[model samples]
Target: MQASPIYIPSESMDADAYQQPMPQTANTPSLENPEDSVDDSTSRESWRDNKKPRQKALYLDNDSAPEHRLSHTLQLVEELIKEKEILEANKELIRCVALTRIIYGDGHWRLAQSYANLAHGYLTLRGLPAQAAQHAESAKEILLNGLDMSKSDEEKQAILGTLVTLYYTLGAAHLIQNNGRESLHNLQKVEKILEELQTLDGGKAVVLKISEKDLALALGRASVLQNKLNSAASYFEKVIDYVIMTEGDSTPELVTIYQEMAKAEQSRSKHDRAIEHLLQAHSIAIALYNKASVEAAEAGLLLAKAYAVSGNYDDAAEMYFAESLRAYQAALGPDESETLNTLVEYSKWLVQIGRNQEAYKLMNSTCSSHLKTSGDFSETVAEVFHLMGTICLAESKMQKAYKLLKKCLEIQTAVYGSQHKKTRQTQELLNMLQKSPTTSEGNKTR
Candidate 1:
């Protein structure tokens, strides 16, 4: 975890720093056209006299060449995709698809590439899994329909590259759509082809540019969707091994591997192992970022949750949770609103286990922080205060509970008028507190 900055930076300065313009692109020089060459059969001297020098120069400088225009236009989509501007990339992709279809018709390889790109765009951006599947299927079907069965192995392998990308996209889309069976089917097909290529290339299939790591990652995700946890773990283990061998711990892939592995462990109720994996992810995240980072806090939050659900109510478990909470705070900073999300999850788990004292203490801390950060009238502050008031009433602190509850009611009424659901709920809490602030029974402990 990183030390919090002693001083705060101005938000406007940060915004200005982030708005720097992109660098300009350099122009490609014109190339000579071989088709415009002088006939050697008519001797060099004869052609040199007949062929106008201007004609040769004009051919070499043909800026409107079809191949050049196609390449330049296609590059626009590629660059946008790299920048993660999916909407802009999709627009460029549509233009390329239309141009390619006009130039070489529907079944052409170039047109198929554009379709595959459109699928990629849809898959990366949420709310379009069906569209992603549509384009992926179109690319695969077009390639299979156009290519001859009798084509050479080299030619087939070349086309299969595109098919491999299409298959991966199709599998990802199916997974997103919760069609696990279909997702697994596509992933299996990709794995088979990759295995065959590995053998044929004598283990030098890096030329294919698709590593075993990539295939394993896809298969692992598919297996997870199918509820095949054991198989998914094995696949993820392979991917983890590959990432460690090639990229080491500093890369983001290593962090993701640890996170997913932790999830698998958590599913099996292997809390100790899950905690270990989450810690590993957290340590790696610390190296990747200098300060409070979303990824690091996520790892810490997962660790805290693991401790809570590990079915232990001992002092050790309590201490572990406390440390995990500190890590969350350290990685997420003092008062980022997102901190509430993790705190809420942890508090709910505490309430589930009947650890009311710990839950109350946590709620108190959260409410204090919320009050300090954005003050009394905020919705989050009111919510935390309401929780604190409920806990106080349970603990039989009548006066304390009444004060906290009334404060929460006032905040809600001010922000959301008395007719609003939240305001009404707060009013109900206040009414209940007034009617019975101190209960006959004492709070129960786990």
Candidate 2:
């Protein structure tokens, strides 16, 4: 929940860095139509080499029976993810996209939802940045175009809900790109759409019970990006307000809301308030761990951080390490980046607590694994290197430290201009290294 200072080493990193993947929508409410199979072979033949033809009625819902198979596809994706089979989950999402593209042409709401969901799948599972951005953009295009169509209030609300997803997805992508301004723009658009939806016919009653919760999420994220910590806290509080008013305290939704509130309060430096919320989140997670590992891990992480800040370092460290390990195990194998990131964070905490040797070993393993999976200059790779450099410096491995630090600086300079905060920090570190007693008089290598 506490965003790390290890941002991308690029000017755009500030813009794109916060672009965490949007959560996938569940049990997508279908428009009134019967479900049918998408003729994949026919679709491939018909559109294989051809471009999508623009239809005059872009918003027209298919009068033909809608594919009932889609509902099952979503269920399968959820199941796959729950089982920690992310690769399979990703495959299912891609199938959904290919099949949906055939059944619902480009620019259709259903197609857009498919794209949005696919983006989330990529983000949560593989951290496929480019794929995530492409799908998000596709979803945005479809939802924006659909808004002009003649639809009922209910239908319009449904469309808006999808649009919210699209905007948030784009926002997240931009955040990762270090394009903070663009991310903020997309997030504000989501906020605007949600504001309108909330006023429509006594709330558009989104099929996803978490629609407003997501809206609050967008606002909280945007506020954080803008450095409006108090505002972020208020937005997260709104999630609690909306859920308590609608679903009451007993729902799983309350658990999620409380955790988010804890994060927002922590960001705002309200440690006591954050601790209170996290305790509630932890209690719920303990009760519901068998039902949802995702929620359980989330609550555990929040509680861990809260405990750490409250001077319960021993317990906090244990919880942090344990939660990180749990997340790694739930990643359905070693290919998931989010799981790796969690591990990296845990290792950083270990180092902070004077467990330098353990931290070094973990960082070494993490760096090697990241290099093998992520390209040489990936954000994650850069972060791994930076952490390694920090460890080496701690151990006074001057040459090794300089080599790693220089590489980290180079990556940051390349991705985020020399003027960027990350790049600047790396440069400062390099300068300090040059002036160290270990360095020769002619130390101008960096």
Candidate 3:
């Protein structure tokens, strides 16, 4: 008989910004544990407060039977994970690890699998790469030992499935820690084992929790981190092929992949290729959502930045920047943070091209809008005041610059206190304006 499969959660494996639909499988694995009731009276927030007491109660209720306690704890782990209580789920996973060791001994593959699952939870659920790496290493040691002792083909296959997840977790954890070489090495191991499993199953891909697309994307990212641009592009191409074959060509899922490809091309100084990928992404955003939508605005912002960096497409850059600003204003309102940020970025570009007067006018109006929306004491208002002050200083308007910097200083002092770097910087600017010859002449005349 085949060993009972342990299904690792694959919900977070997609590299795209948007989630793709996963097929429902009938053979969804379940632990054969007796059902235990949990108190549902407490809200999710209150559960944290009552956690210790509830855990104590669980142990006391099943104190005589380790099996019953393990079963109950495992059920709780499932419920907490489904409820998005990741911290609590992690704690339960720790408990599961200990219980698995007690019930099945240290050399058992199930104990190793528990450790692997916990490691995955640390990386994926909590973003703790160090803890994930530590646990994953432990899982690998135990798993390799167990693999050596396995007799049946079914048992070996099942253990190998767990090994796939274990290696994938290690790769992801190392990737998060920016250890690209280690990450790529572990992911290559995953690919090799997967190939081995396919060969064992008559030269076809085995059904595993982590899909081929996920592996391709992970490998691509690891390759990019390792500065292997050609290898990265190849893996990304595989991802593109997989996505296109699985989903249609025009799906929004293509947008993130295209953006990532553009970034890789940009890193390689392939500006034309980068622009091509960005243009495709922007066109898809426009076609899938309206031009005025937030999605289109974000895509336009990226395309505009790429054009600005190319230095030969100033007019095109400005046009897209203005369009993005307008789209953000229309979709999210004039005073929303996105609209304000887009306005600021456009103004910065104008200033970069020596359109100081236009940039000043734009920022002056934004100051009023930010004051009315985010209030005078907000960081956004302070930033606008600082930018306007800087613009006035550049234009030789000493008195205006002095007043704007004074306002900026006041806001910074109020929000960030007198000793803050921004407050001190604003004060220094005001001091320079005070000592200017033009300002002295203007003050004497007044």
Candidate 4:
């Protein structure tokens, strides 16, 4: 469920498997006493009388001032979250929460901001998916309610930005749930709201940054849902350039963008570009020791798929299929359907590599598991059948091959229609099998 970079063992993991060291954090800024603020306020008018604007600037600056300290503090919190320093980020969030409470008393918009920051910190880190989802949902509720109570455009925009982030979190959760329609609906709302906001205020508003990143990601996701590989490629290409520009080409975020972009490219048959992006993503993942990350797994699988498609059978078999098989096995062990689908893809690669026996074994395992847990109606299972048919054909089992291939064709036509790419592919496979003679036929001819 949690995607991270794959880590190859240098020696072994037994020594460090259970020991996770906490990341370091900076100390929190101290808050001045209320009495000191009161004293300062009392002396303000006399000080203003004695000193000019430039001379009095230093004396008047207070931690409690809206522009002076709060803004800087919020920026610091944002930076910490960006760095993935969860504990320190939470510390900053709590401080902001306390400050907002002090400013707005309680149950007010300021306090809502603190909660939103805390929610963001949880969402950004790799480890806190469930908690992140909960906090994001809570922040969305508070921000929406706060919008009704506030009249200021800036305040409303800030709250709306948080709502945008919350929607993204919700969308990601729905994706995990395999609820494509719900995820698309939530993401569509975010896109619509952002479009409206851009029209009203243009870019550079507080909401704009969040909108840009989230909307681009959503478009890519929606394309995936619709199985429009080209459209997804377009969406990924749009934001990937921007991500590289802002985060540097080597940053983890940029690597993630490239990993997804590679998927789009691979789907479009851009094998060289796909392999290039995959390599970059894999490099970054390894550098970060992100071997267990989603990005790395995705990159490895995509690279393998690309190599298989490009007819580099040896590399596909040795590198791509091997790593992808390991990753898919790791992912599917906990009963993840997505991982099973990936496993099915790896099986396809195996078939391509002349590993019919291995592919058949994988399909059997996949078919058995899916039959027990869910069903055989999934696209993944359909693919497994197709691979099985190909395997049977390779082994000169014509009757079994014909049956499986025909079944696969029927399933594809039922799900995607006769004209769909996948349906057409299955049809072609079936036709080739029907026309080709087996080794047994050659023996009969002799």
Candidate 5:
């Protein structure tokens, strides 16, 4: 899923510069629950106020059914989450968990799902991956370890659905740590469960996000696990077709589909198609949202990368890239990992366009400074070192290049093990350095 780095708000970004929207939870308003409906007669604020009081009254009423009270509390939590009242949402979640435990014991399906919801909320909105990971594991444990197997088929299906939700959060949390393989494994488990259900039902009623229309897209996304770029792109196209059919034109939602499709194209080395999709996203965002919007800024960044990769190192491309970088920095600050990722990509562009010293300086000064905090064994740190080493090699600074490449090898070997593709590449690069008579650092040892 890696392409032009997408922003996942870090603690520094979350502090002031970036705000993440709440994720959709299964417990949220669905076709099954009409109580969460809106009335056109009332203002949004009035509706929220009216609904809260009604839910609160039901929640506190001793005569109300326990299940009904719990549902109302969850509904209120959903409202709090949507409004970005995170502290209130978390507090309410705790109450819901406690009540569920008291009523149905610790193994309650509702309790497990609530934990999964909180896990997702923390990871997506609060930029707290460690806490999110903890809750995600807990959700899985309670569901798999605590839940009884002897239950109705419907109950079992619902539980499995909650497990898929939990696995998705776990995958996101793993991605936060840059554990792509681990993230993929968790997401694959989700697809496996969905596939199993489909096999049992002769491919009927495949559980998917929001609606059955999403199942094809979800499976397409899951195809990424098999490294199937064409399959992934085809699935995203289905989603695109659905969007056009329902909305009659591209909207803000279409921007996400375009971006994902572009990512698939980029992964397949189809830079031209990637650029086209990203440009579409940029154009739509500019028209419907604004230039300063995060979506527009990100789309521009992706488009710039696509242009650079396609060897279009023109002034216009540079300006678009620089403009987008500056916008993101303003909105997300210079220290954000997302901003840093863009800076690295821009540095690579500079190198490709015959500005090696400028590229070297940007990476050596800014990227190196922040990258050190990513830990010595971090794969990201290894990649940065590899890039800097390559730049140094190009500049004929063999001694410095040898040292940097050696460090890259060390980190890559430690993190990826010697058998990994990246580790093998690092070794080959080092071997090439060793074979060079011009190699200045002959006796270097790491």
Candidate 6:
């Protein structure tokens, strides 16, 4: 029996071949007019000069043969997807379902495959989980019926490939919708079918479209949603191992995996293990991209936060915080939101560790920068004023505290209005500062 033509790998097919005109034969209709055909004796150079390149038609008329329409639409889908026109490709996929039904009737496995492909496209390209699940359920019903009627081994294998894709689509859609139990159930079905394929192939590795690493990651995420931390950690570990084997340990791909593993460890209350994973990710990011790169800055910030959360505030947290701030400043200039935000976080950390003098200086500089870049009425400038005022209050600098708090209140009133919670809080602080004993002493001296 001939192998199923259910799927053709787009990469393996020559795009140029599809662009060329099909050869005219008794069975194949010619798109060109016979009167327009040039004489056979015409010079090749003249023919080349006179002939215009035919524009590729995107859609065929309903009168065209269903097989021809299907082939053309499939090629169009491949070209659209390659060009990253995912929305157009998805529309073509919907058309493919109709064409497949026209050619092979309702019960054929190819129709099921078309629905499965549409479901995958909906989920991955458009992020429409409900639509994806609806289409996938349709594919599942058809596949179950096809499986019952299948007689040949090739047919069974072909149906199984579509089933694998269908289940994966359903699993991913459910996962996105936060239906963890349903997601895991569909993903486990995919796993079972994969194992069955492997067994059928005599234990050789079965080459499915979905990679082992992606499958493991999806399962890990689903496990996490289910609060199965141990299972999630194991699956994430498998992903890390697979990635290291395939892409090397120092690849940037490992950074996200390490961070995910760290989160899982943190959820399990294993702070030390979480720190270790974060450090690994931070180091890898710094090595792969320079310390001044945004990637490194983000990784450093996460590592710094992890250190702070673990109470390693004295040296390690401070060092990483400073590193992150410097990196953010270098990658995105000092006036950028990321740089200012990192400065605020690091200043807060400094204050937490009783480095009040340093925190005050940083906040003082940030206040000036924020005022210059964002204006005095901006929330960021208001925040800088508030922090500086609180730092002054802590150190008994009542005069400076009163000045900063007054400025904070002014900005808060302008930006958030007097009735807002932040504005009211700033107003209360200013009132308290006015009633301080030091303020009374300073007033008497003046």
Per-model TM-score on C-alpha atoms: 0.67, 0.44, 0.75, 0.47, 0.53, 0.76
**lDDT by residue (tens digit), candidate 2, 1-446:** 11121111111111122346444444321212101223323423332234223311111223433365455566666666656666656755766776586677766788888877777555546555556777778777777673564677777777776676667667766665556677778878876766666655523245431244554655676666777778778887876775676656666756766776777687777888888898787777668664236566666666766766766556765665576557555743344555556566677777778887787787676546655444556565567678878888888887778877788887777777789988888889888888887754435554
RMSD of 1: 13.3
Cα lDDT tens digits, model 1, 62-159, are 24655554565567555555555545455545555655676778788766766776665555532356666787887887887756645555545555
Which stretches of model 5 miss by more than 4 angstroms? Answer: 1-52, 61-72, 82-84, 108-111, 124-127, 146-150, 196-248, 289-301, 312-446
lDDT of model 4, residue 353: 56
Off by over 4 Å in 3: 1-12, 15-99, 125-131, 144-150, 177-182, 202-205, 371-380, 411-425, 441-446
Instruction: Give candidate 1's error at residue 203 in angstroms.
Output: 14
Candidate 3 TM-score versus the reference? 0.75
The per-residue C-alpha lDDT of model 1 at residue 322 equals: 54
Question: Can you list the residue pairs that collide in candidate 6?
Answer: none
Model 4 ranges with Cα > 4 A deviation: 1-85, 98-102, 105-107, 173-179, 201-211, 222-231, 244-259, 262-301, 307-446
- Runs of candidate 1 with Cα error greater than 4 angstroms are 1-68, 71-92, 121-131, 144-147, 177-181, 196-211, 287-295, 313-317, 327-333, 345-362, 372-383, 402-446
Q: Write the per-residue lDDT of candidate 4 for residues 1-446, one digit (tens) a residue.
A: 00111111111111111123223223312222211222334533553466445433433245457545456557655555455554544554555665666667655655555665555454444334455456566666666663573356555566566566667666655654456676777777777655544443322435232435445665676676667788777777766765665556676666666777777777678888887877787788657655555556666776676676777556554576566556655654524555666777777666665677987886677556553443445576577677777788778788778777777777777778889999898787766765666633643565
Task: Report the number of backbone clashes for model 5.
Answer: 0
Question: What's the ranking of the predictions by lDDT, best on top?
Answer: 3, 6, 5, 2, 1, 4
RMSD of 3: 7.9
lDDT tens readout by residue for model 5, 1-446: 21111111112112111123344454342222112332223413443464556444534454766677677778877677666776556655655665576578777787787777767666655666666677778788888775775776656666776776688767656655656567667866865766545433222232322232243445455556557788788877877876686665666767877888888898898888988898888889888867766676788888887787777556756877776767667777666666667777787788778988887787777656565565546666677788889988888777788889898888898888999998898789888888776683455433
Clashes of each: 0, 28, 0, 13, 0, 0
How does each model score on lDDT? Answer: 0.62, 0.63, 0.74, 0.59, 0.66, 0.73
Q: Judged by lDDT against the true structure, how good is candidate 3?
A: 0.74
TM-score of 2: 0.44
Q: After superposing candidate 6, which stretches have Cα over 4 Å from the reference?
A: 1-62, 106-108, 141-150, 177-182, 201-207, 376-382, 402-446
Error of 5 at 260 (Å): 4.5
Ranked by TM-score, top first? 6, 3, 1, 5, 4, 2
